[model samples]
Target: WVQKSLDVTFEEAVALRQAYLHRYGTTLGGLTAEHQVDVDDYLAFVHDIPIERYVRPNPRLAAMLSAIPLCKAVFTNATSEHAWRVLRALDVADRLEWVVGIREVDFNNKPRLEAYQRLLAFLHAQGPDCILVEDRVVNLRPGKRLGMTTVLVDATPEEEVDFAVGDVLEVGPLVARLLEAQND
Candidate 1:
């Protein structure tokens, strides 16, 4: 349905879903209240997207993540099953120490403080020392608010994230520098 709506970018779609949560206490509730759209239909439409085309494994990314001794986790708005599928396709499934998706966390998605809290709780982490790498500025806000070191991959000028870079492959060197600085 979002693809049919020319006005809806991926970011907009996410915002719409979030709006649903804000208005009706859940995305499905908002869909039902506003559009009369069935929850199942919405789920099917979201799950039907062609994700493989958009994601690919960067061996350099895997190597860098693996080299870091700190625990790593994925905190995504996608369902746990979808997250697993994407990670498996990228061949980095095993590298992740944890994954907290919508279903696993009772459908509380990001920019919700609850989602970040749940993720940290699940990981048994003390605070926001772990770095969060994301492609979207909207997604980074909650993580940033939670005190996590935020890195925006390919951020636009409007985002003004803590660190911005063009490619994930470059993260390895940057992480190395951060580690060196920490040791100093």
Candidate 2:
């Protein structure tokens, strides 16, 4: 689909995908910038998937999420519908307060200043008020620059990340610690 969408050969598509990802943070961002790609059409086409086949319901994750007192949201570069499906598959669709997708920020994907600004506005939040928990270090960099407490989900924490956890499940404890520190 990407090959046809970009009108490039298979190898060209792979290279372009990497280049776009490195340069624009998202291929869609580059596609729209360099090519006259229909954002809606492309997003819908790429996101069409049998999510249930890959993901199973995580009752433990759902329970952990529900136990948190503050409102939680899934902020992603992906489409909102895709996020919803994944959340539903995890049995945690009801746990989150909202899902902030690329469309929500008017197609401004993560690692973009506009994306973070838009998200902060939507949440009526200051950078310091939020905790950004992500698996990718690149994604956390911008949030850290904006004063967000960065929690790297993977064990290897970089300098930009404030905390490290082996898995997302461990994030609950780290978040609690942050809340306690803030109160003190």
Candidate 3:
């Protein structure tokens, strides 16, 4: 549905989804309300894509994440099953102390305060100090707004987020610095 309506490639579809999120709170809800598109078909199309390519293990990243003493969690709009699959594929599932997905949180997705609130509650964490790492600038915006320290992975210059890095591979040194700062 989204692919057909937007006439975009898979990458473009992801970008469009992100753009919609930036413009509206929810992609499916926004498309349905604004374009009168069928949500089921859009979801089906999304599920049709091969996710394996997008998910792969990064051992270096895993090591870095393991070094951080802060409790780590994954907050994603994807279903818990999907998120777990990706994490497992990435070989970092064990590093994460918690996994919060749309299904687990009553379909509340990122950019929504409810999702963040629920994640914080589940982690017994306070706002503002907790860190959130994401690949999308639009997704990082809400984290910043909620006072979390936001890091943008694979972000572009226009994003202008608090911290930007090329990939998860570079996160180790940064996390080390954060740990040093905390100890200091």
Candidate 4:
């Protein structure tokens, strides 16, 4: 479905997808811009994953989120419906103020400067005041370039991160400590 939607041959799909990510930050974004693909149909087709099988309720995660004193929102390359499903599976739906998905930005995903700009505007936040926690170093690069505090989760080398953590559970305490240091 993705190859058909992107108008790429099966043999070329992988390379095409990679090139699209390199050029436009997301393959869907590239398809939307260059091929005029229908955003809704494409998203629905791509994100129809069996989320419940993978996601389990974690009370510790919920507790960690509650400990963070900042306004929280989810910025995802996936559709908002998918994000909602994942959050509900994790039992953290009520913790976020909003979920900004690729559909909201006309299929534009991370690593694009405009996408970040739109997200900051949506949150009524400045880049410096925001913290971006991502597992992919490529995704974190744009946020770091935009002056947001970038935390590389489960990543190696830690070359470009303001902080690195082996688990998402560490984020709340790290934020708290950073806040304390700022105040001091």
Please, what are the lDDT tens digits per residue for candidate 3 over residues 1-184?
A: 5666867788877887787777766686467546767555665666665667887887887888888877788887766667777888889989988788766666567777778888777777777768888887777776777788778888664444677878876776777787788899
Name the regions of candidate 3 deviating beyond 4 angstroms. Answer: 1-19, 31-45, 48-54, 156-160
Q: What would the TM-scores of all predictions be?
A: 0.72, 0.95, 0.73, 0.90
Q: Estimate every model's Cα lDDT from 0 to 1.
A: 0.72, 0.88, 0.74, 0.85
- Residue 142 lDDT in candidate 4: 81
Pitting candidate 1 against candidate 2, the one with the higher TM-score is 2
Q: How far in Å is the alpha carbon of 93 misplaced in model 1?
A: 1.0
- Which of 3 and 4 is the better model by TM-score? 4
Q: For model 4, how does the per-residue alpha-carbon lDDT over 37-87 read when each residue is reduced to its tens digit?
A: 777787778788899998999999999998889888899988888999999
TM-score of 1: 0.72
lDDT of 2: 0.88
Writing each residue's lDDT as its tens digit, candidate 1 over 26-87 gives 56545655665544555667777666888887676678778777677888776677787788
lDDT of 4 at 31: 81
Query: What is the Cα-based lDDT of residue 89 in candidate 3?
Result: 82
* Structure candidate 2, residue pairs in collision: none
In candidate 4, the residue pairs with backbone N, CA or C atoms under 3 Å apart (3 or more residues apart, or in different chains) clash, namely: none
